[model samples]
Target: MGVWIRPEVFPIFGAVGAVVGICSMQLIRNITTNPEVRVTKQNRAAGVLENFDEGEKYAQHTLRKFVRGRRPEVFPNMNKYFAEKQ
Candidate 1:
Protein backbone atom coordinates (compact mmCIF):
# COMPACT_ATOMS: atom_id res chain seq x y z
CA MET A 1 0.00 0.00 0.00
CA GLY A 2 1.24 3.51 -0.88
CA VAL A 3 0.82 6.43 1.48
CA TRP A 4 -0.41 9.63 -0.18
CA ILE A 5 -0.46 13.37 0.74
CA ARG A 6 -3.46 15.47 -0.25
CA PRO A 7 -3.14 17.42 -3.55
CA GLU A 8 -3.55 20.78 -1.73
CA VAL A 9 -0.84 19.82 0.76
CA PHE A 10 1.64 19.18 -2.06
CA PRO A 11 1.55 22.82 -3.23
CA ILE A 12 1.85 24.02 0.35
CA PHE A 13 4.89 21.82 0.83
CA GLY A 14 6.46 23.25 -2.35
CA ALA A 15 5.79 26.79 -1.19
CA VAL A 16 7.30 26.09 2.21
CA GLY A 17 10.33 24.44 0.60
CA ALA A 18 10.82 27.42 -1.69
CA VAL A 19 10.64 29.78 1.25
CA VAL A 20 13.12 27.70 3.21
CA GLY A 21 15.47 27.53 0.24
CA ILE A 22 15.35 31.29 -0.27
CA CYS A 23 15.89 31.95 3.41
CA SER A 24 18.86 29.54 3.53
CA MET A 25 20.40 31.23 0.48
CA GLN A 26 19.95 34.65 2.06
CA LEU A 27 21.54 33.43 5.30
CA ILE A 28 24.53 32.05 3.40
CA ARG A 29 24.96 35.29 1.48
CA ASN A 30 24.79 37.34 4.66
CA ILE A 31 27.41 35.15 6.30
CA THR A 32 29.77 35.31 3.32
CA THR A 33 29.31 39.00 2.43
CA ASN A 34 28.90 40.66 5.77
CA PRO A 35 32.18 42.30 6.89
CA GLU A 36 31.06 42.82 10.48
CA VAL A 37 30.24 39.14 10.93
CA ARG A 38 33.86 37.95 10.65
CA VAL A 39 36.74 39.66 12.33
CA THR A 40 39.96 37.88 13.23
CA LYS A 41 42.55 38.82 15.82
CA GLN A 42 45.13 39.60 13.10
CA ASN A 43 42.59 41.67 11.17
CA ARG A 44 41.69 43.63 14.29
CA ALA A 45 45.36 44.20 15.09
CA ALA A 46 46.03 45.36 11.52
CA GLY A 47 43.10 47.75 11.72
CA VAL A 48 44.41 49.23 14.94
CA LEU A 49 47.94 49.49 13.56
CA GLU A 50 46.86 51.23 10.34
CA ASN A 51 46.97 54.61 12.04
CA PHE A 52 50.73 54.39 12.55
CA ASP A 53 53.63 54.36 10.10
CA GLU A 54 54.48 50.85 8.88
CA GLY A 55 58.05 50.58 10.11
CA GLU A 56 57.47 52.14 13.51
CA LYS A 57 54.21 50.29 14.04
CA TYR A 58 55.81 46.89 13.50
CA ALA A 59 58.64 47.74 15.84
CA GLN A 60 56.19 48.87 18.50
CA HIS A 61 54.02 45.80 17.99
CA THR A 62 56.97 43.46 18.36
CA LEU A 63 58.14 45.19 21.47
CA ARG A 64 54.69 45.16 23.02
CA LYS A 65 54.12 41.49 22.23
CA PHE A 66 57.40 40.18 23.61
CA VAL A 67 58.09 42.56 26.42
CA ARG A 68 54.77 43.66 27.86
CA GLY A 69 54.62 41.71 31.14
CA ARG A 70 57.95 39.88 31.16
CA ARG A 71 60.02 42.99 31.36
CA PRO A 72 58.01 46.15 31.50
CA GLU A 73 61.17 48.13 32.09
CA VAL A 74 62.33 47.30 28.57
CA PHE A 75 59.31 49.06 27.13
CA PRO A 76 60.80 52.46 27.77
CA ASN A 77 63.95 51.57 25.82
CA MET A 78 62.11 50.30 22.72
CA ASN A 79 62.70 53.51 20.80
CA LYS A 80 66.37 53.42 21.66
CA TYR A 81 66.73 49.78 20.59
CA PHE A 82 64.87 50.38 17.30
CA ALA A 83 67.00 53.44 16.63
CA GLU A 84 70.15 51.31 17.02
CA LYS A 85 68.79 48.70 14.56
CA GLN A 86 68.58 51.33 11.83
Candidate 2:
Protein backbone atom coordinates (compact mmCIF):
# COMPACT_ATOMS: atom_id res chain seq x y z
CA MET A 1 0.00 0.00 0.00
CA GLY A 2 2.75 2.46 0.98
CA VAL A 3 4.81 1.75 -2.15
CA TRP A 4 1.85 2.44 -4.44
CA ILE A 5 1.12 5.81 -2.81
CA ARG A 6 4.78 6.92 -2.82
CA PRO A 7 5.01 6.89 -6.60
CA GLU A 8 1.91 9.04 -6.99
CA VAL A 9 3.09 11.62 -4.44
CA PHE A 10 6.51 12.05 -6.04
CA PRO A 11 5.10 13.13 -9.41
CA ILE A 12 2.81 15.65 -7.81
CA PHE A 13 5.73 17.16 -5.90
CA GLY A 14 7.80 17.37 -9.07
CA ALA A 15 5.03 19.17 -10.93
CA VAL A 16 4.65 21.68 -8.08
CA GLY A 17 8.39 22.32 -7.97
CA ALA A 18 8.49 23.05 -11.69
CA VAL A 19 5.72 25.58 -11.44
CA VAL A 20 7.39 27.35 -8.50
CA GLY A 21 10.74 27.47 -10.28
CA ILE A 22 9.23 29.04 -13.40
CA CYS A 23 7.36 31.64 -11.42
CA SER A 24 10.47 32.58 -9.44
CA MET A 25 12.51 33.07 -12.60
CA GLN A 26 9.89 35.37 -14.11
CA LEU A 27 9.71 37.45 -10.91
CA ILE A 28 13.49 37.89 -10.87
CA ARG A 29 13.54 38.92 -14.50
CA ASN A 30 10.85 41.53 -13.97
CA ILE A 31 12.64 43.04 -10.98
CA THR A 32 15.92 43.29 -12.84
CA THR A 33 14.47 44.90 -15.96
CA ASN A 34 11.76 47.18 -14.63
CA PRO A 35 12.92 50.79 -14.13
CA GLU A 36 10.05 51.70 -11.85
CA VAL A 37 11.24 49.12 -9.33
CA ARG A 38 14.66 50.78 -9.07
CA VAL A 39 15.39 54.48 -8.88
CA THR A 40 18.65 56.12 -9.90
CA LYS A 41 20.29 59.54 -9.38
CA GLN A 42 19.81 60.32 -13.06
CA ASN A 43 16.06 59.96 -12.68
CA ARG A 44 15.96 62.13 -9.59
CA ALA A 45 18.08 64.84 -11.14
CA ALA A 46 15.99 64.78 -14.28
CA GLY A 47 13.02 66.27 -12.49
CA VAL A 48 12.93 70.06 -12.92
CA LEU A 49 11.23 70.65 -9.61
CA GLU A 50 13.52 72.43 -7.17
CA ASN A 51 11.52 71.47 -4.10
CA PHE A 52 11.11 68.10 -2.39
CA ASP A 53 7.31 68.34 -2.34
CA GLU A 54 7.12 68.73 -6.10
CA GLY A 55 9.56 65.89 -6.66
CA GLU A 56 7.56 63.61 -4.39
CA LYS A 57 4.41 64.41 -6.34
CA TYR A 58 6.07 63.51 -9.64
CA ALA A 59 7.43 60.24 -8.29
CA GLN A 60 4.10 59.25 -6.80
CA HIS A 61 2.30 59.99 -10.02
CA THR A 62 4.73 57.90 -12.02
CA LEU A 63 4.49 55.00 -9.59
CA ARG A 64 0.71 55.14 -9.67
CA LYS A 65 0.76 54.82 -13.43
CA PHE A 66 3.02 51.81 -13.14
CA VAL A 67 0.82 50.15 -10.54
CA ARG A 68 -2.18 50.70 -12.73
CA GLY A 69 -0.42 48.90 -15.61
CA ARG A 70 -0.22 52.05 -17.74
CA ARG A 71 3.55 51.65 -18.30
CA PRO A 72 4.21 55.35 -18.69
CA GLU A 73 7.63 56.37 -20.00
CA VAL A 74 9.44 57.20 -16.78
CA PHE A 75 12.74 58.59 -18.00
CA PRO A 76 11.31 60.82 -20.70
CA ASN A 77 8.68 62.07 -18.28
CA MET A 78 11.32 62.81 -15.71
CA ASN A 79 13.34 64.68 -18.29
CA LYS A 80 10.27 66.58 -19.38
CA TYR A 81 9.36 67.38 -15.79
CA PHE A 82 12.80 68.85 -15.20
CA ALA A 83 12.94 70.46 -18.61
CA GLU A 84 9.67 72.19 -17.90
CA LYS A 85 11.18 73.50 -14.69
CA GLN A 86 13.64 75.44 -16.80
Candidate 3:
Protein backbone atom coordinates (compact mmCIF):
# COMPACT_ATOMS: atom_id res chain seq x y z
CA MET A 1 0.00 0.00 0.00
CA GLY A 2 1.06 3.59 -0.64
CA VAL A 3 2.04 5.91 2.21
CA TRP A 4 -0.97 6.85 4.36
CA ILE A 5 -1.14 9.62 7.00
CA ARG A 6 -3.90 9.81 9.58
CA PRO A 7 -6.52 12.46 8.73
CA GLU A 8 -6.60 13.71 12.37
CA VAL A 9 -3.03 15.08 12.09
CA PHE A 10 -4.03 17.60 9.40
CA PRO A 11 -6.15 19.83 11.66
CA ILE A 12 -3.51 19.80 14.41
CA PHE A 13 -0.87 20.96 11.98
CA GLY A 14 -3.22 23.58 10.54
CA ALA A 15 -4.06 24.99 13.97
CA VAL A 16 -0.40 25.16 14.99
CA GLY A 17 0.54 26.89 11.73
CA ALA A 18 -2.27 29.42 12.14
CA VAL A 19 -1.20 30.26 15.70
CA VAL A 20 2.42 30.64 14.66
CA GLY A 21 1.49 32.85 11.73
CA ILE A 22 -0.63 35.12 13.90
CA CYS A 23 2.08 35.41 16.55
CA SER A 24 4.75 36.22 13.94
CA MET A 25 2.56 38.83 12.31
CA GLN A 26 1.99 40.46 15.68
CA LEU A 27 5.71 40.45 16.43
CA ILE A 28 6.52 42.02 13.06
CA ARG A 29 3.82 44.63 13.50
CA ASN A 30 5.16 45.55 16.97
CA ILE A 31 8.70 45.87 15.64
CA THR A 32 7.68 48.03 12.69
CA THR A 33 5.34 50.34 14.60
CA ASN A 34 7.43 50.68 17.77
CA PRO A 35 8.03 54.40 18.39
CA GLU A 36 11.40 53.96 20.13
CA VAL A 37 12.80 51.97 17.19
CA ARG A 38 11.84 54.72 14.71
CA VAL A 39 13.66 57.53 16.54
CA THR A 40 16.03 59.44 14.25
CA LYS A 41 19.35 61.15 14.97
CA GLN A 42 17.83 64.49 14.06
CA ASN A 43 15.08 64.05 16.61
CA ARG A 44 17.62 63.18 19.27
CA ALA A 45 19.76 66.23 18.39
CA ALA A 46 16.74 68.52 18.34
CA GLY A 47 16.07 67.57 22.00
CA VAL A 48 12.46 66.76 21.28
CA LEU A 49 11.36 63.39 20.00
CA GLU A 50 7.58 63.06 20.15
CA ASN A 51 7.80 59.37 19.58
CA PHE A 52 10.06 59.00 22.63
CA ASP A 53 7.39 60.18 25.01
CA GLU A 54 4.78 58.07 23.27
CA GLY A 55 7.05 55.10 23.57
CA GLU A 56 7.67 55.78 27.25
CA LYS A 57 3.93 55.99 27.91
CA TYR A 58 3.10 53.05 25.71
CA ALA A 59 1.81 50.81 28.52
CA GLN A 60 1.64 53.02 31.64
CA HIS A 61 -2.05 52.48 32.20
CA THR A 62 -4.14 50.86 34.90
CA LEU A 63 -3.16 48.10 37.37
CA ARG A 64 -0.83 46.15 35.13
CA LYS A 65 1.66 49.02 35.05
CA PHE A 66 1.75 49.26 38.83
CA VAL A 67 1.99 45.49 39.21
CA ARG A 68 4.89 45.29 36.78
CA GLY A 69 6.85 48.02 38.63
CA ARG A 70 6.52 46.65 42.15
CA ARG A 71 9.83 46.09 43.94
CA PRO A 72 10.64 42.42 44.42
CA GLU A 73 10.83 41.18 48.03
CA VAL A 74 12.03 37.88 49.45
CA PHE A 75 9.04 37.72 51.76
CA PRO A 76 6.35 39.87 50.23
CA ASN A 77 3.73 38.82 52.77
CA MET A 78 5.90 39.42 55.85
CA ASN A 79 4.73 42.93 56.70
CA LYS A 80 5.72 42.51 60.36
CA TYR A 81 9.39 42.69 59.45
CA PHE A 82 9.11 46.42 58.80
CA ALA A 83 6.38 47.24 61.31
CA GLU A 84 7.21 48.32 64.88
CA LYS A 85 5.74 46.34 67.76
CA GLN A 86 2.69 48.09 69.20
Off by over 4 Å in 1: 1-4, 39-86
Candidate number achieving the greatest TM-score relative to the actual structure = 1
Error of 2 at 14 (Å): 1.2
Question: What's model 1's overall lDDT?
Answer: 0.63
Encode model 2's per-residue lDDT on 1-86: one tens digit a residue. 89667776888999999999999976885565544444576765676535666445545665476678554566878878998999
Candidate 1 vs candidate 2: the TM-score winner is: 1
Q: Tell me the number of clashing residue pairs for each predicted model.
A: 0, 1, 0
Which 10-residue window in model 2 sums to the lowest lDDT? 29-38
Ranking by TM-score: 1, 3, 2
Clashing pairs in 3: none
Candidate 2: list runs displaced more than 4 Å: 1-5, 39-86
lDDT tens readout by residue for model 3, 1-86: 13577777789999999999999986885666565554566645665455656666654544557678676666666755665444
Query: For model 1, how does the per-residue alpha-carbon lDDT over 1-86 read when each residue is reduced to its tens digit?
Result: 13576666878999999999999986885566444444566665654333336445434555477766674454658867887999
| Deviation from native of the Cα of residue 66 in model 3, angstroms | 25
* Winning candidate number (lDDT): 2
